[model samples]
Target: MSDIPLEHVHREPDSDTGNAVFVLHGRGADEQDLLPVADRLPGDRHIVSFRAPDRLRGGYTWYDLDLSGGGLESSQPDPDGFRRSLDMVAESIDAAVDAYDLDSDSLGLLGFSQGAITSLSLVLERPDTFAWVAAHHGYLAESHADRSPDGIEGKPVFVAAGAADQIIPASRSEAAAEGMREAGADVTFGTFEGGHGIGPDELEAVQAFVEEHD
Candidate 1:
């Protein structure tokens, strides 16, 4: 769209209900990376996936990871880059709302790894902006600490983690759930037996969650 600066690819719903599920890919991936994942989700809503602005390796990254000390497991998001990506994503969503005639109240989010962290940060500070969220193999970042669990009570959120994940440990995802639960979000935290990537079980569970809420 002319008003939207972010590069995105969308899949139209079979039947539009003015609803949408915005899918965010992990670092080193682009909008197209998550289209298959979105297709598997059960919803009669538009699917949108966006490319992160910063290019790295052979793909895109939402923010840089500072792995100087404890490495990827304990690394933190670069404040400046994270903030910029956040603002740009917000702008994209606003433009999408106007361009697609979407119902803002029916918007949901699905993300993986770095994308999950970004998604969680976005919704945590502004819970009312989205209806539900599903984060896979990702955790909550310490940078954006504006969590108001009370204001987000009864909100549905599904959190999936890999028991053997090395990149962003399962413990981090558990902690993310704890934080969201405090925020009064109806969280579904699931730990599958695997590594950093989403597995079949995780996909099935997430699909079920989206279906239940849809």
Candidate 2:
């Protein structure tokens, strides 16, 4: 869909494993930001992180945010840019699978902040693309989040957030978990003691979740 593919950084596993995880970093972050997180995962997973389509600050953005109406927690994603990134992300996953000879059925999704929002929407929009998902500190998109009728039945989703988070409050993540559950996802919502970032306990829980699915 996009003429110029999203810029990305990819790491291959030591073995010939076809399993892979598509990582998406937060707003104002690059593809490289989440590569280190992948090291905490298993050695057999191929980690690929994609740069957002637009440049913002010193990093990248999946879409513009509208905070005019309320606080940061109430900010909504600009629909046009939001939907555009969704398409690009889908394309990128397809390209990655073909380019690296990865297994489509063994795909996983990992994302944070705006990237988390994108990942959440994708699993709803294209449920079959990923086997599991991990979304940290983000909420469901406010617009154009169309879940297919059949829905993501039995899909495994891990949503972690800070209980004291002001950026995208814990309540928002709770609602996200509810949303995914309503769509038949096997959701595991993890809450850490801190605010707006993952903690060691949260990381361990996330790692365990991934390990279970992998």
Candidate 3:
């Protein structure tokens, strides 16, 4: 769908373990933003982090935002733009698996904020693509919430929300967790004391989820 190529940073594990993890960065962040977290996660899994295609301000964004009314909300995402980016991410994952000769069965996704939104949407849209998912400080976009939940049944999902998050309120995050649970996913949901950001506790939980699922 999208003709634009996906740009990324790939890190190979010390040994070939036939597994891989893909990292998706928050809004206004680049591919390198999540590289450190990839290193912290357990296992010898190839790590790949993709840069969002759209440039905004000094950084990149997965989708445009509507900061109207003094709150953060996704503008009606351009359908073509969203589809193109999603297609690129899917293609990139296929390419990575093939290039690294990695096991497709063990692939995982970790994303924060807008990146987390994309991760959840992708996994919901194409549930078979990821073995597990960790979405931090993100909620399911309203546009993508009507899909059948059957595809994600039994899938492992981790949702970390910031209790004081002004950008994405806890109520929204809780709703996202409920949505995942209703989809029959084995969801692990937690909330930190901070606001709209990840911390050490969140990281530890993510590591545990990855270890348990992978």
Report lDDT (CA) for all predictions.
Answer: 0.86, 0.87, 0.83
Write candidate 2's Cα lDDT for 1-214 as tens digits.
Answer: 2433788888888888999999999999999888777678754878889999999999999999988768677898888899899999998899888888899999999999998999999998888888899999989876634453355998999999898998889888888888888778999997899997777898899899998887
- lDDT score at residue 195, model 3, on the 0-100 scale: 92
Q: Cα lDDT for residue 44, model 1?
A: 83
* Superposed model 3: Cα runs more than 4 Å off: 1-4, 66-70, 73-78
- The Cα RMSD of model 2 versus the native structure comes to 2.0
Local accuracy of candidate 3 as per-residue lDDT tens digits, 1-214: 1332578887888985878998889888999998988899988888888999888777788876644535564333456666777787888888877876879889999999888878888899888889999999898776687665566998999998998988888777777888888877889999988998888998899999999999
The positional error of residue 1 in candidate 1, measured at the CA in angstroms, is: 1.7
Model 2 lDDT on a 0 to 1 scale: 0.87
Segments of candidate 1 deviating more than 4 angstroms: none
Q: What is candidate 3's CA lDDT for residue 182?
A: 80
Report model 1's TM-score to 2 decimal places.
Answer: 0.95
- Summarize candidate 1's per-residue lDDT along 1-214 as a digit string, tens digits: 7678789987778885888998889999999988878889886888878889989898999999877667889888888998998888888988887888889999998999989998988888677878899999888888654477445888889999999999889999999998888877899999999998877899899999998885
Q: In the order shown, what is each candidate's alpha-carbon RMSD?
A: 1.4, 2.0, 2.6
**Which has the higher TM-score value, candidate number 1 or candidate number 3?**
1
